[model samples]
Target: MNTPPHFGTDTPRDLVGIGIGPCNLSLAALAHPLAELDAVFYEQRPRFDWHPGLLIDGARIQVPFLADLVTLADPTSPWTFLNYLRTHHRLYPFYFAERFHMQRAEYDTYCRWVADQLPGLHFRHQVDAVRWNPEHDVFEVDHTQLDTHGEAEALGRTHTRNVVLGIGTEPYIPDALRPLVDAPGVPVVHAADYLTHRDTLLTAGHITVVGSGQSGAEVFLDLLRHRPTGHEQLHWIGRTDAFAPMEYSKLGLEHFTPDYTRYFHALPENTRDRLTTAQWQLHKGIDATTLAAIHDELYHRTLGGGWPDTVLTPGVRVRTAGRIATTKIELHLEHIQQNTRTRLTTDAVVLATGHRERSLDRILVGLDPYIRRDNSERPRVDEHFRLVLDPSVTATGCNIYLQNAERHTHGVGAPDLGLAAWRAATILNTLTGKETYPLPTRTAFTTFGLERPQPRVPAARQAAPTLTPLVDRR
Candidate 1:
């Protein structure tokens, strides 16, 4: 195996990555070979973790194992799921288990293992700000290092030719739940922190789970199954009519495939928006296992010959929730059909609401004047994933690329594991002026896989003309 190159303290690097999520993990793997170009990945966490809060012991990945960080884009790459299994000596046992998809914990372990093998990864480094330096045509990044006491007290700086920002999603709590975030002794928390307070909530007298997505349903089912027989009650409320299952058809799953992203990007703006709105159910829907778990809990309670303390109220919106005391919470809800409001008291309220993309406002403050925006107020990106800069800005062939930040322009595959490797290679190609990072080769008999590599077009067919008729006339 070839070792990655390193730079001296004074040597300038080619690029600096803001976060070390799976998106940039793929980039680090692909960019490893560019020895002349120095790169470093900064992560705020003390170690590698991908959605650690949601890595329930029995929870399986929504997508297949083959759709890992790099497999679909680079099957032969060492970072493939098969390679991960082989490296960990679990391939045979995994096959014997007869499971197509392993638990989310296992998947997360694989990612962390891969991250451990990679170099140039800096942890405990939280980027505080980024400023554009026009004179040097580079970005100046300011970061702080957390000390033993968890206080950020040390400051550092680095200059790079370009930067790739992949600061993942932020938990999205409803506006009404904002007050409860800092309330004293209020057992109100988002689903992302479920595991942190699972024991407390499970033992509570009455628990109400808000939202109807996968997280909400999972929390409700888990609580319903584990809570004491007659002491605890479980209540679920959502805007939808029961938890809807994700679309699992071959064609429906294609929305996260590269082909679908290409097709979606080629469509007109209005048509693309229409398609996205129409297909929200494909990705936003919950898992069937969660719904079935809820059903089983209900069936078990019915067989006991007594009414169980569990309620499922669909199409209801939470109007307000207040902490009545140190131990209880009051919720005001309005049902869609009843058109009348009602109130309920519960020991805990778990908001299983989803997440939204992190806003780029703070870090990109200096570059905001130069960055172009699309109709949705998101940054406009070029085909190479570079931010579309204003004409006034100039560079020494430097380009700021983005990963997991172009959901509107790139479609569903923007934040998915399927596209990570490809996006990284695209950025590499734009930077190196050559296709040096080739994807790994795979054999035909792989259980779950994409089609073989496609033929590359010749230079003439791929190149864009430098002098157009209008330019010549001018």
Candidate 2:
């Protein structure tokens, strides 16, 4: 096997991707087929680990398996769920199961398997910054490769015709718990790191989980199931009255459909902002299965003549969390209904708080003057998901596209797994003219050692195929 030469300053690549999350994974799969385009994805992790911490046992994806990274975008694409089943020899079992959704673990496994088959993906390469080289009409990416101890060893730089920002989301921690992060033995952790401390949390006499989303509920249930009898208690704290279920109606689920995203982008700016604020519960909410599990556990404990040490502190907000000692942490809670404040101590704190989109400022610092922002302070992107840059910088027919960074403009579907393959194809079509090459239907088959075949114009659509051009601010 030939090891691809290391990318450096002198060797200019067609594209350099900053992150290899599912979002960019889809892009890499699509770009691999375009022999004319040389692209590579730089991932910080040694290997792929998507939502590893929240892979609770028996937890299935809330979305259907059909909405996988590639299926919805390209059904015939090899990256489809069907291909995953076929490659794993589980096609018969999956068909017999007659299930549309799958366990979160299984989905993650599928993603990892696909990732392993894709080349030009540099693992353990963490990008530190991306600056636009106005003179050269390219991006200068600075990154460092980490060793086993997570220490940077090889410092390197690469220049690319364009850059795709798919850095994904950052775990959000509440302001109240910010202080506890530095305290000794505080055990203050976000839900993104739940698996790291699952055993410790299970052994703790008292555990408090803050947040009411899917992660929060999952953590609460996992703790309840794993804790030794009469040894530990779990408390679920949230701002909402109860675990709000995700909206899965035909029309509601449309929020994740491409057409809806287009509709959302066409709406007035004020209308889009209003929709996002009003529909926060739709995507940020928990699944019904998790809610039911909590309810069932409580009911079962009640039937056993006593309440298992569990409490749901809904409609309450944490005002502050501080370390009272090496072994305990104090939580100051404000009850919304009663208008009362109460103090509680816990052995450990699990912040089920969610995440926010990664900011582009971290990478494209030099191009900050060109990037536009929406009313909500997110990057303003066009329908094709390119950042609206200032007219001063020559775009060199090179476009900086975003994968998971356009939720505000594109709706909830922007960051979803369903749009992954479609977004990649969109970018590919935009970079290379419609007449350049036809897009292939199957995205999973092996081509030139790459996982997917190149995009080829269909015989029928060749004459009037849509043309997507690179953004030329010049």
Candidate 3:
């Protein structure tokens, strides 16, 4: 980096963001007009791209268009998605299209466009580590400059009063299928890279998809459309008991509201953990449109009479897997309900097993002693999104905020695009000790608990309990 003359250890920036994913990008865009707050964001990628490999044709984002980077928090901001359309001279086309939900590719392009104009966003600069200097009471962020090809060229550091971690998540490869996915020339892959390996997968004789989420459904539908009708040898299996549509009902979606998030955070830790596991369908379920497309494709093939030579099974677990020669994969699966075992062979496997949060332990290693953790040993994030740091660390007034890494503390909406701006605004409000974006006291019609501790929390939001307590202390 050129290290613009004004930015140095002696001159600390107000904030420094680690990764330029959509989360941090939103923060940067919102912070752009705030001349008082000096902030800079670093990214390893050469440019912004949201799930580039999963930008399959006809795939649409689950959230509405207004859930874009800046709109939800600051609709009038010039960086809104509407402005992206206007800038590209496609506003009329977009208006006529009436697409409430944006296409995945278009969303990626919109983010790229926004990233291009946002100043102080350093692309090709990989943030290596962050350490707090007690003497200076500022964070020292070390990063390496990368060339266009992503090769490291030089090292540099920046000093900041605060740091935001938005490194995002990583594609998860299941343990049973790890060997094949790691081996050279093996076709087993994760759905995150579906587009990158589309041609090879399309040519494969028998393909098996190992997830039932939205990505899995989209990949299966895409493959079905291109393959010959009757010869479509595909197997789609998942651990879910049944293929389920996302909970998109008006009231059901209240779970993603700020009110619900706060309520969820105050619950007992064990209860929160159980709810996360049981509420998989809330965020992990397939979108209704994608589910319909898959069914419509299958129904179209049925017009010719026999099944489309595809096996769609649920409630099955992949017990183990092995390879039969180099070109074939053998999956040992156990039917969870029936307690029966079976073996299936395939030419290629797409493990849309979903993603796991990228660890902050690597970069935050220097501050480990001062960082507090939850019962699970994961870093604890308070209601304000700041890490629950020890007094020693908090004494410096150098806060560490998190993005998309607080699902355990925040709920399913932690990673949802709709809540991105709200979270950014919340973090900014708390960071600056000012309401940059004043938020509603409550947002959801449904109150999560029977007990309302605050008078400001409306009574209409809470429902009257009709059943007696299961465990009677009386």
Candidate 4:
């Protein structure tokens, strides 16, 4: 990148965001109306697109429409999803349809609409590094401006009092199957790129899906519907004992509320680790509707008094994988309960194993000395979502905030869509040292722990006293 003179002025901004995914987009939308706070967000992508490869047809997001960009925190904001529909003249049609959950594609479109109109959002700009400048008492942000083709055009620098990182997660592939996917002319692929290879996969002789989550279920169902009835040759397997439905009960869903998140944050480190693994069904299970659809499709094929040529076993996992004569794939499987082993061959494989949070070591390398880490070497995040840095850094009133990177400290709600608005509001309130957005005292019906949970209500606004005119009575 061509290094040019500094692009920003001597006056530092209040906040600088590193990534423009849904989390940072929510923060930008909420920060827009606060005239007192000056903030800007940067995104590497040329435009906003949420999970473009996974936008399957007829697939709906897990959360309701109310969990939009700004509705849960500030419904009156112009960036709300309702406002988007109103401006596009689709409110009446949406109302007449009576749909609570929106399709995945529509949600992507809604985000793009907001990204197109929102100001102070610099797209095609990639933040390179962040460091503390004690001399100026501000964070130095170095970024590279990219052209439409993602080539570096120029290098610029900005100074900010605080920084927030919202870089999102990446697709995860198992180690045993990574070689198969990396090899050329192989049909093994992760579900994140399923749509791009759907036609090629559908033409294969037999297909195998290696996950039990919503994405895996959706992929299997989509492929099943396309194949012929009697000739359908498919296999679905995972590590779970059974295909379980997500915990969607009204009371069970309290786990995703701010109350539970706070309670979980205060627990012992070992206890928190155990709960995260035990609560897999909360966020990593199939939807009931999708499971029912799969069963219905299978039942329809049995009208001729013969079962469909398919196999679905839950307690099985691929122990090893390799190529079979370069024409098919071989998988060595094991049943966890029975301790039995077998081998299966398929023409193609779809791995819907899910995603892992992108590491922050590269960008935050400059701030390593000040960052306080836990036993696992992970950054310690406080309840306010600020990283617990050394006193030398905090003494200058410069803070480093986080979003969606606090799952270990905050709980599973760190990645939930329902908590995005609330978290953004909390971060803003903490940054400005005032209640920029008023949050609720309570959100869930159930109290999480025996110890009384603390109320998160913002401190009462300190209004100036009204003085009456001094009269003769004085």
Query: Whose TM-score is greatest here?
Result: 3
lDDT of 3 at 328: 86
Scored by CA lDDT, what does every candidate get? 0.78, 0.79, 0.89, 0.90
* TM-score of candidate 4 against the unseen true structure: 0.92
lDDT of 4 by residue, 1-474 (tens): 122334777999899999988899999999988888888888888888798878988888988999898888888899889999999999999999899988889999998888888778888889999989888988999999999788999898999989999998989988888889888765988999999999999989999999989999999999999999998899999889998899999999999999999999999888988998999999999989889999999999999899998999998888999997888999999999999999999999999899999899989999999899998899999999999998888887789999998999999899988899999999999998898899988989998888677767555765567999978965
lDDT by residue for model 1 (64-89), tens: 78867776656777888889888879
Model 4: clashing residue pairs? none
**Candidate 2 or 3, higher TM-score?**
3
Lowest-scoring 10 consecutive residues by lDDT in candidate 4? Answer: 1-10
Order the candidates by TM-score, highest first. Answer: 3, 4, 2, 1
Candidate 2 lDDT over residue span 56-94, tens digit each: 888888888987776655676677778999987999999
Global fold similarity of model 3 (TM-score): 0.93
For candidate 3, the lDDT comes to 0.89
How far off is residue 127 in model 2, in Å? 1.6
Question: Candidate 3 lDDT, tens digit per residue, 188-263?
Answer: 8899998999999988999999998888898899999999999999999999988889999999899988999999
